[model samples]
Target: MAVKTIDDTENYTIEWDEEIGAIVFTWDKYVSGATFREGCEALLDAIKRRDAAKVLTDTRGINAHDAEDQQWMQTEWMPRALDVGLEYSAVVHPDSVISEMDVESILEGMEHSGAEPLVTSDMAEAREWTAEK
Candidate 1:
């Protein structure tokens, strides 16, 4: 397995980490609604192509997200992800309080999405947890 950068931009990078057999999305700055939608679509495509079941999402750089985007993630994306073999999701807690609140809001909807979710501020811990069956 080899690591591949799926999408890299000024705001974020979405990659496939072969070591963990997961798609990792790392935020480099606050993500606008359009950027967030683009990233999510790329992530879904990567997961399907790789048959990945785990995900590690690093949101520390994001300060906020649009309410409509959050709603889309919760109502549409999360369910679609679970349908496509997403079994575990490890979210790295954001440093910004506002971003953290957004994460919490998303998690509330994910509670019943059939994927196990873990919230942590440590990347290493997130990797370890996502790697576990």
Candidate 2:
């Protein structure tokens, strides 16, 4: 699989994985507000630019999310992502229980968006699940 870097920042990196035909978001530590929103938008643009439907989000390094950011993600970003043909997502959860719970809460609100989402602690599992047709 060819991995092309789309956007790289201190907080996160978004890439296009050609082999699996998925946009991958690899996060680093805590990110919030504008940084978080920008990263999400960049991921959406990557999906549209590559004409991809699946996404793999590696949140292993992330430790927390702002409440406002989480709300924005579920209410704003998610719908736009789905509108742009994001059909499936695999999230590699962070080790922090609080962060994991936050991720779960965000995912819960997205359940009705018609996208299949898999949450796991293992990167291999996430990759495998995201690549599925």
Clashes of each: 0, 0
Encode model 1's per-residue lDDT on 1-133: one tens digit a residue: 5779988988778888878878898878776677778878888887888888888999877666788988988888888888889888888976666666778787665667666888877888888888774
List residue ranges in candidate 1 displaced over 4 A: none
List TM-scores for all candidates, in order.
0.87, 0.92
- Give candidate 2 regions above 4 Å deviation: none
Q: Pick by TM-score: which candidate is best?
A: 2
lDDT of 2 by residue, 1-133 (tens): 6999988888889988877778889887677899788888888888888888899999888766789998888888888888888889888887667867888877775668777888787898888777774
Q: Give me the candidate number with maximum lDDT.
A: 2
- Report the Cα lDDT for residue 89, model 2: 83
Candidate 2 residue-wise lDDT at 113: 72
TM-score of 1: 0.87
